[model samples]
Target: MYFLSKELYFPPVDEASFEGVLAIGGDLSIDRLLLAYRNGIFPWFDEDDPILWWSPPERMVVVPSIYKVSKSMRNLLNQNKFSVTFNQNFREVILGCQQIERPGQNGTWLSDDFVASYTKLHEMGIAKSVEVWQNDELVGGLYGIDLGHIFCGESMFSKVPNASKIAFVTLIKYLKEHNYKLLDCQVHNDHLEKLGAIEISRETFMKVLKSEEINFSSSIQQHGR
Candidate 1:
């Protein structure tokens, strides 16, 4: 374990020692947050707790071209009853996600500080959101940091059944259209696995991250255009 300081570069993170926890304690300042995303690390901790950075041993990810859409989902897509949009209402989406109660979890980890930090990232054009709407009401959505061709998803929520799934599918479709290679799910979950997310060794994930060519600022500008 290493203690983070303003001057120290994040130590060499080992896949085998993921449970060892590389570093702890740091402000989610723009510089540190940017560095963390570039190196496949992210903050996840309770509100009263110090910032805990983690890079799990097995990275869960979905390649846009290969995501699985079930028969029911296909029908939903055909109906087109719900609409999807990008960066439409980021604040609403984040608040919705934060309010959702996860099974077995007593409270949300999406603290006020977390919201403010990510909102700042969104302003910088690095964090993007996908919103799912039915008629005119925002129902479900997801948000993440856009690292060139990779989207490191943070969290998602659904107020109605299949709403989150709709947002996720729409996100993949948009990524496919725009040439994104990978959607980093970050951790494993049975629900995500059903949508074709798979666990790969952290080393493999890091290799992909290193080799992928990305121009973040240009991508943001293009999206704005």
Candidate 2:
């Protein structure tokens, strides 16, 4: 693996190890984060480890036009039981993601420093959160990097049944309406697969990023318009 520095660069994704670890030790500066996303690389390390960068051999992605919502999910949507909003309470959303436990994981990767850095990105309008509220309580949410056309999802959490799913489904509808090119889930899981996210070759993912299909005007509409 490669080591990073203050210079703000990561080696090509093609040079990554067989396990897809590309580099290590890079600070999560805004510039580095932008550069990393542009190159199809992202940071994913345990709180105890130095920042590790990766470009997976196969990328997990969701296309808004093709995303699937189950019959039960559709029924839930029709019930209008939850309210969804964007950027309404970003800090709370991310905090939920950091604290909510998941199976097969010992601890959260969202350390305090990671939260601070990502909150900065949110302030700069490059990161986004989807909040799901029920009876005036924040029940579920998700947050991610918005590289214009592609939203690189970081994490999501649900405190109630289908709360996180509600938040995600809302986001998917918005993206589909607004013509977002892709939702970059970064990695795959059975949960995402159930929602119609699929694995594509890294080369395909990189090509989509290079297309720059999302831009400022496209993003502004997402800000409560």
Candidate 3:
């Protein structure tokens, strides 16, 4: 592990050391944040902990077009009971995700600092959100960074059953409509796998990220209009 300083260039973190944590305790400046994402790294730490950057050895991702929609999920989609929208109430989406508790997580990782940093990114048009609604009520949604042809999904939460799924499906539909090629889910778990997320090598993931130059401004314009 290394102490990242404002002047020190980030080291080339080896995949083997990701388990040990490559860097710890750094301010979430725009430069640092952008550099991390560009290198396929991200910050994930609790409020009580210092900033911990991670780049897991095996990257989990999903190809937008091939996401698995189970029979039940398909039925729910067909029913159209829930309404979906984009970039609507982004703060609300982040707050909703923070309030919900995941099965294994001790508590919310979306701390105040995390929210503030990502909110700044959102303002810069690099981070975006997808929202799901039920009769004027906010039920579920997700937020992530747009890196070129890739959408690096961060977090999502559901107030009602299938709400998150709806948000995810809607976002992917929009991605496909706009010609996105990949949706990076970040890490693997049963939930993501069921939704068609698969594991890829970190090298491959970085290679793809390096090859693309995303224009988030255009996507934001298209989405808002």
> What residue pairs are clashing in model 3?
148-214
1-225, model 1: which lDDT tens digit per residue?
767887636777683254635588878888899998898888878888887788888778877765667898899889988989999899999999999978889888899888999999999999999999998999999999999878999999998888889988888888888877789998888999887677765766777689754443353244342
Candidate 1, run of 10 with poorest lDDT:
216-225
For all predicted structures, in order, the TM-scores are: 0.89, 0.91, 0.88
Error of 3 at 59 (Å): 0.6
lDDT of 3 by residue, 1-225 (tens): 778777634666573274636688778887788888877788878878888888887778766655556788789999989998888788999999888978877888788878898899999999899999999999999999998688989999999888999888778878777777678887778898778667766666766687754333343244342
TM-score of candidate 3 against the unseen true structure: 0.88
The regions of model 2 sitting more than 4 angstroms off are 212-225
User: Residue 80 in candidate 2 has what lDDT?
Assistant: 92
Error at 190, model 3, angstroms: 1.2
Show where candidate 1 strays beyond 4 Å: 212-225
* Alpha-carbon lDDT, every model: 0.82, 0.86, 0.79
Model 1 TM-score, all chains together: 0.89
lDDT ranking from best to worst?
2, 1, 3
Q: What is candidate 2's lDDT per residue for 1-225, written digit by digit as tens?
A: 898878987898999988789999979888888899888999999999999999998778777876678898999999999999999899999999999989898989999988998999999999999999999999999999987778899999999989999988888888888878888888878998887677776766777788934432333244322
What TM-score would candidate 2 get against the native? 0.91
